[model samples]
Target chain A: MSRSLEPLLTSRYGIEESWKLANAERAGAYEVARQALTTRKPEELREEVKKANIRGRGGAGFPAGVKWGFLNRQDGEQIYLVINADESEPGTFKDRSIMDLDPHRLVEGAIISCFAIDAHVAYIYVRGELAFSVARLEQAIADARQAGYLGERPFGIDHAIEVYVHSGAGAYICGEETALLNSLEGRRGEPRLKPPFPAVKGAFGMPTIVNNVETIASVPDIVQMGGDAWSALGQLPGDGGVRIYGVSGHVKNPGLFEAPVGITMRELIDDYAGGMLGDRPLKAVIPGGSSTPVLDPRRKVDAPNEDHPLHKWHGQSEIDVPMGVDTYRALGTMLGTCCAIVMDDTVNMVEACRNLMRFYKHESCGQCTPCREGTGWLVDVLDNLCNGRGKPDDVDLLVNISNNMMGNTICAFADGTAMPMLGMVQKFREEFMDAAIHGLPDGVRHDDSVRSMVEGVA
Target chain B: MAFALTPEREQQVDDILTRYPERRAALLPVLWLCQRQNGWISPEVVEYVAERLELSTAIVKGVVTFYTMFFDEPVGENVVWVCRTLSCDLRGGKAIQDHLEKKLGCTAGHTSPDGKFTLLKAECLAACGQAPMVQINDYYYENLNVAQLDRIIDAHAAQGGEDAAAEFSTCATFGAPHGSRGGSVTSAPPPPSREAVRLASQPPPANDEKGEGS
Candidate 1:
């Protein structure tokens, strides 16, 4: 609920028919884009973004301006800009909101991004499940083109641009920049090994800058507000811009919440989402999406549990931190995608971990050995733990498998799965122990004969 | 080959191919068209897509196999994706899946006996706020409980694929909203998006003046 001078992404979220282009323009949608293209040089525009220090909202938190700087301007290749609309991360639905509610914001943002990078064409690889959002975005593109916001020297830019929305066939790995490039090129959605990173070689061997939808969507606002002005909004030096945190799970008013950097996870849940649903005591929260390490803020921030291996590895105690890239990284977790998932008293952490792992196991592109095999192994062990067939060392073994998988894949996918998996096993070892022999912890309602494998049951 | 794009669909495929510099880049869209027309993408459809896109069938097959949404085998008339991710599961996604399984008389990834529905537990449809939702064919039924889902199933179970669409029905609203010039493309380059045709049959509004008398 708390935000800066004005709401950015969610400013027109709830307004009826805000997705329409005319309404969006009436609400000040394309002005910034027009200003950027007409007034500012491409380098100036990029500098404004760079000065803002706005990190990628798509989980990586890589600075957008720096990413644009990677474009090989002198390469003489047709530069490409790909909007990673494949927002397949579990619990992350913020991109879809911008696409469904204020698609012009995204299109304008894409236009500005393309202009900044000097790219002629951009593609939005929409998630297959987001049929409505895609339809809405495609229509937005057509509208923009019809209105001359895109194509053939519109807005007084010398270069014309075309934006297209392509449907992703449904794979979470496709959300990865490299994997997305492969998918975009009509290949299997597997991570292309880096070193020939997308900036150097991407989308049919062209200089490419693939950015998250939210990241690009913020460009228009940054250009209008100026970089220094925008950066000044953040609580920290590098932290600026309003991040649309998609709060899901046990929160009372689960929806997209746009707040500036350094917004504490507590404020996001307690104030914005109206706290835990049904007035239940808080248990834990996935600080940023399901992939980020789950934090147990509900537990008192007591002395370090040295006995816990993760506590020993990270050398951190039971803690409290704000929701930001640096803070999460301090906890050995990433503020991935700004998808905050809340868990309250009634839930079981072991089962929750299993649910998360199920997504990872299913989404692994399978080109990498560690993620393909290790994730399924993690799921099976968690399944055994839930079904009362686990050992005391099973949690430790889970941690071991996670450690082995980290940094050993074509993508950070193994680490994404492993880091969070390690967090669950290390932080909630007791819950796994309880679930192993004694069944689910007290207070959870479940059938005695049911199993906990992600895929076994209907 | 068991199937081929009709001359109209072939033109549509060519239109999609023109969007990309390379023909192969239209792979996914062409496959979507194939799946839409023929309930699932079979080997023949894959080959047909390969021929249209100028890619090898091996490449096409690899792409299809990687994505979970591409059904290689035949599916029922309607496919139900019940989200069983963390948010939805916490907010009764499992119970919704269970309810759907019982109603459809099949487990996840299985087709019903009557060949009308296939219930599958999807990872997340990204409608976490509207937890425990399902996407039947293209229309998303969100904020669902067992009863709400049951009513939807009853309304949709008997309908064929052609009879169902992502019910934007009003041409004016659908086209007017996104600036699509009333849902169909005014440009001669690519054909109207599949959505234009699929959504054209949207039922008239309930309270509209035309619906009352006409």
Candidate 2:
């Protein structure tokens, strides 16, 4: 397949050579920038992005045009665009790759987005812990300013747009757009209530549009290519042109790939990721990022009669059950950040849950009471299960705690924290229960591995 | 208690503050500059930032503590921030942590005995494809394992070799260097991509050799 028109591999592209505005201009990158700046009206710019059907690539494949449309136009308040580059989701690192390789693409996209929303300032909220990324973005911002692409009245536009790169203090909650704004404003990173969604009240209590790095990065291309042509690129109903899904664990070619949304897990694993490593059997797949529920390989009963150009659609009946934004949502999980984590038979379900619990516990911002305390409790519970100290009641306790933690916190950080525990209990309740049952189920000794651990050492 | 900004430092602060419409808006960048000057964010220096930004001491204090990058406690002469995210975890970041603790006799989040180094476990350094990575000051060292980590520490120890022998100095208030200027801290160099795989895939000392026998 031709590499042209694909998601640019950030690693392959040199920072100063292929990524910056000057490099893009030299390589015909700003052909669209020039047009968008000089010719296209702001409203037309919005319409074109809408037509391109570029869905947010930071997960929850919301249509970029529609999200931008949500902005409540105020007469005097300045609109802002915040790029969420907090790529802290356990399996999601595609944004990090893009930012590191070609931060300029994001800058260019943010500029176009700012122009569309009538915004004057944009902030890229990177994870505070990522020193290298923050530095890369800092250098890119400096370069953009020098090239007259950013800073006051850039590109001769009457409106002034100053791009700021703010590093978060490592809160997964900050990944939630509103919480990110809170942190940027120098407050504890906590999610704000909706109704004042970022479009209404965001960074510095102004109208803001928080888009994923990949979403804004796609804007330059959409502006270059006609919106309809870009929209046509996504064959699925709400499918977008290209996505950088980071695949990890047990995959042969484990790395980041740019594929259309309709691509199935099987194809991504087989064709793109070069199938399972060492020819091992695939046991489960976390289709989206770490937060999405794990799907059993056996239960992947592909809906009969599904058809989509990009997907492995067999017939028409299965179209409603496709794997992109429309389908993943219908299946009760979002294609959040497209971090496909593969697990083989060798992966113990109890152990996986324990590992995920550890991540959620470590990353929790300790803002809301449920999330702050609930994450650690979940991990402790799972840790007990993994270490074979689990009781039958512990399973219910996990579900109860996770259930309480959902949607009750300041941020969706609570939800990302809760999803894995609920998912493990839902999918592998039997495995957990079997591990929990000790020496004997009915007065007969069972010499199981879990039993030995629970019975105390020999 | 205030760390007075030298005339030149004041000018730099003024330049940055002017860029933002509101003085409070420049809190993050100004604090970053402050940390660079002091090597760590002390309460007194934070109070100084509070006064310079015209923000309440509480506000500056809140901002400084909220962000993880700014260390409240004093660190070693060099800061090595290790990424403990999934990508790094998959490629043996835990092993690197083990090696670091062994080499420096300090666990993650602890400063070395001689105060020559401090190991901090950060979330994501954003270089995932390289897997297991660390950031020394500002540079990213990717595709790391135990040996790569040791080599990095050794190199730093060698460069700041003399400083390692110094006693722990509990720094109090910020001291203005002569000329009303802050210390010029050099940014770390970026890692060469060619060395990623070899550096990341290096096996540990005993276990790797034992596996070779099998």
Q: Which regions of candidate 2 fall more than 4 Å away from where they truly are?
A: A1-16, A151-153, A302-322, A438-458, B5-9, B160-214
Clashes of each: 3, 8
CA lDDT of every candidate: 0.74, 0.65
Give candidate 1 regions above 4 Å deviation. Answer: A1-3, A298-320, A442-458, B158-214
Cα lDDT tens digits for candidate 2, A1-458: 11124443232343233445565567555456556876789999999888888888877677889988988867788888889988777777677655655677778788888888888888888876565567678888888888787777678777677887876665676788877777777666767778678888877778889988888888887788677766665547656565666676555555666655565677667666666755778877777677887767555434444453324433322212346776676555567877777766655666566666777887787768899899899878776766568799988999999999998986677787678678778878887787676512332112111111101001
lDDT of 1 by residue, B1-214 (tens): 5678778888878777767888778888888888988889898888788777778889889888888889999988888888888877776677677778888899988999998898887887777765556778776665554554565787676554334443321112322212333333121111121100011111112111111110
Least well predicted 10-residue stretch by lDDT in candidate 2 chain B:
B168-177
lDDT of 1 by residue, A160-251 (tens): 89898889988988899998988888888878988887898898888899999998888888889898877766665476767777677675
Per-candidate chain B TM: 0.74, 0.73
| Residue A102 of model 1, lDDT score | 76
